[model samples]
Target: MSTCKNCQNQLTPDSDYCNKCGARVIRNRLTFGNLFTHFSEEFLNYDNKLLQTFIALFAKPEAVIRSYISGTRKKYVNVISYFAIAITIAGIQLFILQRFFPEAMSMDSISTEATKEFNLKILEFIQDYQSIAMMLNVPIYALVSKLVFIGEKKFKYNYTEHLVIYMYLLAQLSAIGTVIIVTAAAFDLSLGTTSLILSPIQFIYIGYALKRIFNLDWTNFIMRTLIFICALIAFTVIASIVTGVLMYFNGDFQKMIEAQKAANEAARTVKDTIN
Candidate 1:
């Protein structure tokens, strides 16, 4: 008999892993080659759970989601792990943009100096705390989904289940967006332009996934997608209002106006010099 190092379970002499804890029976001492091999098997292998989950979600989101919801968890990566990976990737994307392509994220086209500063600050804040922002959006997305799909009886899903759906959808979208952005950056593409192009694509994919999950027909899918868009717009407006109020309290609003006037005068002086 052999004792498992991880859980002290007794195993047959030739067992490759512990039957109780599933830890590999590492008879050999730890070495760099074995460590690299372990890393490859965990992450880079085509049979790895993460890679399998990523492909399956794109190919058949409905099946993966439904299976997970129905208590079939082992086949795919869980929702929390998937979302965590998305956040990590998103953070890396932001870091790359800030570090390598600072000009791409710069708001140079805006006319007012104060407004530009304010906008840049907002952008910086989002980039700095993007993980929190992404996590916060997940629940809001779940709420929006619940509102849109409240009438379904056959696929009656509660609030938490809706969270699972959006977590998967949003994580998948984030992964896709990161790949697209990174590729675009390699070609010296404008980050803002790339992001704008991705907005509609993200919406379409979200709708497609939902359609698959609910088995919705063309008419229902279109109607629901429109409603989802409207809900998002409404949420955006409300959030803007709240943010504006906070800025006003902090005296940023008044400063912005004064700065805009100064910027305008400066622009006029430059134009006069050229003329």
Candidate 2:
């Protein structure tokens, strides 16, 4: 037994605080090393949690997100915070690649001018609305997942609960996508090849995530995964239709296509003049 340093109350030697007065008892002297030690301990768990977050997020996302939604969130990052951080990371990846690797993004890497133009349009759309597009997909994804898994006998996660899963999934994808882009840039990989490599990684991540989350048998897992993917495709089609309608009514879609055509024609004319 020992005495409290602040209140002189009796306490155990290992006690961190005085029980009587509730004063801290294990304080260390303030110095550069101690300051950094304390700062790092609080900084990592309370605020700067991306590293520990990705550890669970990539390795066992279902478990982590489930724990979070279940209200035990001391160890896992908040879902919305993770999603926002992931978006920022993806944006940074685009910024770095655009600023540093111009040749990798040039039309020379693609097979044809038409393909290049298509990719350019897609990229432009993504750059303009990727964040909003991704956010909107979350609820649509949750709805699809719920409908697909509505027949599960063992466990049935509710619609709201599925949002937790989808949010974590998107966060993981954004983080992994950022890494993929950075790697592709480093290796001078073309966008087509990058997508080819990334698609499988994305599928595998979600596959294992579902596997762990639902504890499904192989047959059910395969069935659910396929349906989930199809649901995502359906959601994409619906979103595209909605986007097209909005653009059409506002004259943006036609203007965008016309602008693209004009640019392509101008490039051809310049090439012909040079030749």
Candidate 3:
């Protein structure tokens, strides 16, 4: 223990500065070198620990979640941080894939001018409405999951636990979709059809993960899976319809661009005839 010279406040031996008056407290025999050393010792170490924790998290998600809920949270990253990092990585992959993959962006090499216009409009609408769509999806998924899990009290997981599991599944699904989009884009493969097939597979993976994570029986798992799948299909259909309507209205923007292109071509043709 030590005392602050200015305020005469008692301080712990481990404290570098006085809490009461902000006076610098001397460490080990009041030596300046000792103070610096003590301060460094107190605050400057743990890179390896954090790395190890992340490794465990990636390798053993169920164990990590169990540990977290069991009050050993400080040993691993918070769930929100994990989700954020996963989303960021997925987003980057999607962006890169879109930049490099021509086929993923378009269905055919020679899309009709109208179809091209429609696709561009759809892309623009996605950019504008993505956040709203995500927000809406969350509550809808929660409600659907809750309803699906009802009467399955044998699983021993609460509604909130199920919700967290759904969230984890959603994050994983998003990441996988990002990878698929990027890869399809790189190969010039149209993702429209690929997405359709991949959606069900993704749900299957989610169901498997949920079963393992929650120790659910096969019958209950399949029932919950079907319910979730139905919810997903409904959500997708609704979203597609909404986006299609928006794109229909937004088509005029693309038409103006096409018109400008045609006008320029006509002007060039006239200039060439005169020459």
- Per-model TM values vs. the true structure: 0.92, 0.72, 0.57
Q: Sort the predicted structures by TM-score, highest score first.
A: 1, 2, 3
Candidate 1 has a TM-score of: 0.92
Q: Mind giving the per-residue lDDT tens digits that candidate 2 earns over 7-61?
A: 8899986888888999878657779997787778855554556667788777777
Q: What is the RMSD, in Å, between candidate 2 and the native fold over all Cα?
A: 5.9
The list of candidate 2 runs beyond 4 A from truth reads 1-49, 105-118, 252-275
Kindly give the stretch of ten consecutive residues in candidate 3 with the minimal lDDT sum.
45-54
Candidate 3 residue lDDT tens string, 1-275: 66887899998878888999897775448578877876666445454433444455345556665665566776666666555655676557646655666446553343454465555555555445644544455566766767776676555555566555555556556666776777666665675656665767776666666676667878877777877788767877887688676645878755657766886799899999999
lDDT of candidate 2 vs native?
0.78
Better of 1 and 2 by lDDT: 1
RMSD of 1: 2.1
Measured with C-alpha atoms, the lDDT of residue 133 in candidate 1 is 84
Off by over 4 Å in 3: 1-61, 69-71, 107-122, 127-136, 155-160, 238-275
List per-prediction Cα lDDT, in the order shown. 0.87, 0.78, 0.63
Give the clash count for each candidate.
0, 0, 2
User: What is the Cα-based lDDT of residue 116 in candidate 2?
Assistant: 51
